[model samples]
Target: MVFELSQSASDALWLETHQQFMPVTSADGLETISKIPPQLGKGYEREVALQPGVELHIFDSTYQDIAIHIPENQHPVQFMVYVSGVADSGDFIYQDANWGYVGGSGIQTPVRTFFPGAQHQVGVIVHVQPHLLAQLFGNSESKLQPTLDVLVPGDEQPQQVFSSPTTGAIRAVVRQIIDCPFSGVTKRLYLQGKVFELMALQLEGISTPVCQNRMLKPETMARVQQAAAILRSHLETPPCQTTLAQRVGVSDRTLRRGFKQLFGTTVLGYLTEQRLALAERLLRDTDLSVTEVVHCCGYSNPGHFAAAFKRRFGITPRQCALGVISAQS
Candidate 1:
C-alpha cells in the first residue's frame, strides 16, 4: 500500500490504512495498543504517553512492501531505532540496529519505503517537545554541545538529520522497553526513564567525533556487536579483550577501535556501564540486598561497588532500593 499524509495526521492516517485495527486503551488512558490487520500482516504497534511532553511508540510487525510520503511540515524531535527490516528514504536507508534523529520546523519530507522481509521490523520511536528537550539541557542559557546544537536550532538554522549504527548498550535499552515488566504509573515512569536514556545515548554518540567519522566495515561492526552480546550474556565473567576479539574473529586492535567508533566507549568501559545498569535494575525491581546486588553484578568489594554505583546513578544501592531515587532523577 502507498499513501501520502501530513506528519500531524497520524490518527487519521492510521484509521484510513488499518480500518480493521481497533485501538485498545489502557485503564488509565495512558497507553493504546493496536494489532496489525490480518490482511496487512502480523504483530502490533503500541503508543504510550510517558509524560506531558514526551511520547513513546513501539512497533513490531511485518507486511507487504509499503511506501509513505510525508509532506513538508513542522515536526517534533524524534529518536528512531530499527531492530530489523529495511526502510529506504531518498537520502538515507535504515536497517537492523540503525537509529536516527529528525526534527525541526518547515522541513522538507522524504518518501520512506519499507520492504517486506522474512524478519519483523521492530523498534521504538521517541518524541520529545522542543521546549522539554531544552529544559532537559537546562534552558536557553546553557550552552548546547556543538553536535547537538541542531536539536534546538535557531529559527534561521537549517533542519538537520543524523543517523548511525546503534551500540550494544542502546539495543539492550530498546529490548528493555519492548519487554517492560511493569504497569500503570510504574510503567509510565519506567518508560519515561528509558526514553531519556535513549536520548542520552544519542547525545553521547553525536558528541564524540570518532563516532561521527569512524565507520567500521560491516563484518567488523558485526563482530564488535557479537562481542558486546557476549559481554551481556556473561556479565558475571566476561571474557578478556584478547579472548573476546579471538572469539569474534577480529584482531584485538580492531575490536578496540570498533568499540570506540560504534559504541563511543572502550570494551571495558562498555562492560562497566552495562554491569552498573544491571545493578540499578536489580536494586529497583528485585529483592536482592545491596551486597547480593553487588555480587550478582560481578563486583567483589562493597565499597568499590557503592562508589561506582553512586558515580553512575547519583545514588547508592541502598538509596535506590529504598525508593529514595527514581530512574529519571
Candidate 2:
C-alpha cells in the first residue's frame, strides 16, 4: 500500500483502503478496533481515547510492504514505541525496541517505508495535545533542555525529531499496554493509567543528559559499557564500585567518570534504576507478592522497597500490581 496524506488524515485513508472493514466501536465511543483486510495483512489496529487530550494508537499486524508520505504541516506531540519490524522515516529510522518523538511545526515531508514480509509491525503511538504536554512538563521559569524545548513549542518554533533505543523500563510499560486484558470502561481506565506511566517514563528518558562519550578513548568506552552489562547481570547482588571497575579492567575513578560521561549517572545510580525497573516489571507482570519482589530485586526490606518503588514510579509496588493509580501518579 502506498499513499500520501497529512498525518491527521491517516484514518480516513485507512477507511478508504478497506471499504469492507468495519471498525468496532465501544458503547462510549472511546475505543475503536479495526482489523486489517485479509487481502492486505493479518492482525488489527486499535485506537483508544484515554482522555480528552491524550490518544493511543496500537498497531500489530503482518502486512505487505507499505509506504506513507506525511507532508510538511503542524503536528501534535507524539511518543512512539516500536516493538518489531523496520520503518524508515527519512532521517529517523524506527525499528524493533526503539522509541521516537515528533513535535513542533514545519516538518519536512518524510516518506516512511515499511518493508514487506511476514514480520509483525507492533507498536504504540501516543498523541498528546500541546497544551496538555506543557501542563505535564510544568511551566518552569528556567529554560527547558533543547531536546524537550522543541516538544513544547511556541507558534514559531522549528520542527524537531528525536529517537533512541527503548530502555528496559520503557519496554516493560509497553508490554503492559499491549497485553492489557480488560475490556469496556475498565479497559479504558487501565489504559489511561498506563498512558500516563509511559508519558512519565519517556519524559524522564529524554530529560537526561545526552551521551557525550565521544571524547573518551575507544577502549575506555568499551570498559564502561562492560561495567554496565555487569550491573545488569548482577542486579540482585552487584559488585561494589571498585570491584566492578576491576572486573571491567578499569580503575574505580575511571569507572565513575566514565559512567557520568557516558550515561549521565554514577554506577550506583544506574544500578538502582535497573533494580527498581526490574521490580516494576515483576510487580505488574508476575504473580509475585510485594515481599518476594523486594527480595528478588535486591531490596532486603519490604518497606524500603515500597518506598523506593513509589518514589521512582509514583505508585507503590502493591498499587502497581493492583493497577491502582495514585493521585500523585
Candidate 3:
C-alpha cells in the first residue's frame, strides 16, 4: 500500500501509511513522485506509506522555516529528528559548511565540501502528533518560540561530536528500528514510542547543566539554547534534532557536541533525569502510587520507571514515596 498524508489537529500533520522505495527501474517507473504540493518543493515535509501494514515517515523539509504562511496554525514549534543517517546543508546549519551524522557511523559530525549523500539506506521518520504537541505546550495559543537546532561536532576533550555516552544508545535504537520496521498497530505504537524517545534523547542533554553548557560555543550557542528552551517548553513531547536543526539552521552533531560539553550528559539522558526528578518530587510530595507516578512522570511503563527510580535514588519508587528506603542507617 502507498502512504498518504492527512491533516491532523490544527498544527500537526499525520501519516497513516507504510511506504518504501521501489527501484527506479522497476515495473512502475516514475522519475519523481510528488506526494505534497509541488510549489512547497520536493522536500516538503511529507510522510510516506510503504508496503502493507508498515507506515513510516522520514521528514526532510524546510516547512518549519516557512510555516508562517500556513493559515490557522495552532502548533507551537516545528522540529524533526535526524534518525539513522547523515545530513549536511552547506552554509545552512554549520557555519563552516560541514556535514553531520544523525545516526550514522563515527561521531555525528557535519560535513560540507564533500557530503556522503544518503550514506546509509535504512532511515525512519515520524511526525509529531497534534494532540501530543498541544498537551506539551498548552499555554501558548500562537506559535511557540524556537528551541534547539541542529548540533555538529566540536573540538573538545573527548574530541567527539555528541555530549554524553547516551548518544550512542539513541543511535542503537534508531538502528534497530531501521533493521525491523514495525507493522500494523505495533508499527503505530512503535513509531510513537520511537519519536517520543528521540525527543527525550534530545532533551536529555538539556536537563543537565554540563550537557547544556557544551552547547555554549560561539557560533552554535544560540541554537543550543533554543533547543534547550524548546525541550524545556514541552515536558510532554519534544521535537527531534532534525526538526530542531532545520528550523534554526544547525547540524544535529553541533547540538550534540555543545550539549555534551556544556551539560556533561547526552540530550536524551538529561531528559530522563528531568522526568525522573519530577517523578521523585511527586512521590515525595503527593500520595500517588508508583503506577500513577509513572504516568505523571511521562512514563507508560511502571516496571521500567520503578527500575529507573531505584537506580537514580537507590530506592524503588514505592520505597522512596513511602520512606521505606533511606540512605541513613
Who wins the lDDT comparison?
A: 1
| Reference-based TM-score of each model | 0.57, 0.57, 0.34
Better-scoring candidate (lDDT), 1 or 3: 1
| Model 2 bad stretches (over 4 Å) | 1-13, 27-29, 37-40, 99-108, 141-147, 210-329
Give lDDT tens digits, candidate 1, residues 1-329. 44333434544656765666568897877788988654445778999988888889999998655555566556677778887655555333333454454443225355454454445788888888777876675434433344345565655444455554578888888899999888888888888888888887866654454335535653455456567766765788789999999987899999999888867799999899878977987788778999998888888899999998888888888999987775543
Estimate, for each residue in 36-147, the C-alpha lDDT of model 3 and write its tens digit. 3332222423243433322344434322111112222222222233443333332223111111122101132332222233233223443343344335433333222121
Q: Which stretches of candidate 1 lie over 4 Å from their true place?
A: 1-13, 16-19, 37-40, 98-106, 138-144, 210-329
Per-residue lDDT of 1-329 in model 2, one digit per residue for the tens?
A: 44333444655656765677678886667778888755456788889888888999999988766555565656677888877755655333434454444443334345454445566788899988777877666565423334345566566454554444478888888889989888878888888888888877766554443323335553465466567756765688888998888876889888988888756799988888879977876777679988888888888888877887788888878888997765543
lDDT of 3: 0.44
Worst 10 residues of 3 by lDDT: 95-104
